[model samples]
Target: MSFISSPVDWTTWTPVIPATLMFIVKDGRILLIEKKRGLGAGKINGPGGKIDAGETPLESVMRETQEELCVLPINPRKLGELWFSMGDIPDILCHVYRADDFTGTPTETEEAVPLWYSLQSIPYQRMWEDDIHWLPLLLEDKTFLGKFVFEGDSMQWSHVETGVAW
Candidate 1:
């Protein structure tokens, strides 16, 4: 079988926007949000959103968690990064994080409904298709960097690099 390659020059293509995704863990359970609106709506995902101008990825994750889950993530650690692309679509550069501690209560918000699931039972089928490829590595405490090209929600190509977190 022949392989299909993206037309864009990934080596030089820059992400048009920066985003964040933070998964908070406690007692082997992970915190997830069922998005109520906007992109990836109705799907289960970590609490995070756009990295505002002049804000670091860490700040963006913290702000998004507070806005979407009503809690302050504590001791968040960098897990990895995911670079996404689609033909003619804007690119998204996402920084993924993991937090084992937090302050305040996690509650339902206008943006999402907070829920927890066993780490072993993450609902991958209900998340973006690319998640299954890299989430497992993160759960295993391995840091990773990955890139994916997609046509809508369907993944067309992907590459990942795994290593121990520094």
Candidate 2:
């Protein structure tokens, strides 16, 4: 008998954890990217991308922003971290950062089209389902830590509540 007769199984779903950086301004506006393809295509999100190996979160954010938006975020602070799982694809453990200062002009890259939106006027139709869940806390200068669930591109639910904030 052959000792190696294990069947190959390829049916599995897991969340993809990508390190992301969100650029924020004192004007309560956030820079977002309109995805062109894959996952939330045509949807809007912060300028970010996957974290490379042996790279820190800050470094990853800088590189990703330059590659995708061609902008440099300045004086950003490490605000909080979050864990999100949509279906069974990959769990996204995002380290959220805030930048009250930044420089350079954002350019539209292949992955996204750069745009800015006020917090209240955020285009929900263009964002992931869970974005509405904890985004408010972010705008209020509150550090956030939470988990959210989503089915495909729509957020299913969340159990998050920020105590108090600025």
Candidate 3:
């Protein structure tokens, strides 16, 4: 595959948008969502959204989880970070978290439909291409940082480092 290089230098990159993603893993199953609107719509991913002004990443993750899945993640732990450069679009920095427990039921909303998949059967083909590269580190409870450049939905270039301190 031919890879496109990022125009912006990653070492000095700053994201125009900051977001969060939370996965609730329990009993060998992980909770994900079929996003119905906004970026990554029609794809399966964790329930999360952009962080609001004055909201910490943790606060944003909890709020987003509740808004998208109607569940309050309990004792959520930060797992990693993902940075994306999608062509001319501004860069995005997403903080990822994992919650082994939560309150309430995973329900369908106008924004998303929650689904549980076994850890061994995560649907990578239905998610962003970069997910297949870093999600395994998340499932293994490893800390990581992933950077990627994309053209539309296709990943052009990528880098991932595990055991990274966030």
Candidate 4:
């Protein structure tokens, strides 16, 4: 079967979950986590989680960062949004952010093992496949909108629109 099947018909589907992710960078390094529990466990990703009822995406990202890493993100900028769909799972809408300022040192919590990596040496093989496409744009301080279809944990197809951050 072709991985690139047909694009999802958003008009007929609804994304039930709203999530957030933040990348904290400084001096050419970025903070990532090895999730110890919940969705995407064991994968390397930025700190973030589901947006709670009555909370904005930015608020959720900051709260998640503090809960997962024991640090509060400061001045986080909205980098993009990603919509994901899998064969039989409910769709997900994820808001992505980049935070260059934060208070306190990041410490590993029960939810994640926090680690820092040089931008050029990011462990993409250990992250979600869709990250490979949009992360570079983030590194360049560009904004993007992305969509992806996944089969299980593997990305079946993806599309990204760049240059809309400003």
Q: Which candidate leads the pack in lDDT?
A: 3
Candidate 1 lDDT tens digits, 42-149: 999999999999999999999999999999999999989998886656899999999888999999999999989999899999999889888988788789988888
Give the higher-TM-score candidate: 3 or 4. 3
* Sort by TM-score, top down from the best: 3, 4, 1, 2
Runs off by more than 4 Å, candidate 4: 1-5, 11-13
Best by TM-score: 3
Q: What lDDT is reached at residue 143 by model 3?
A: 95
lDDT of 2 by residue, 55-93 (tens): 888888887777778888887776666566656467776
lDDT of each: 0.89, 0.70, 0.92, 0.89
- In the order shown, the candidates' Cα RMSDs to the true structure are 2.1, 9.3, 1.8, 2.1
- Could you tell me which residue pairs clash in candidate 4? none
Distance from true location, Cα of 148 in model 1, Å: 0.5
lDDT of 4 at 128: 92
What lDDT score is found at residue 52 in candidate 2?
85
Clashes of 4: 0
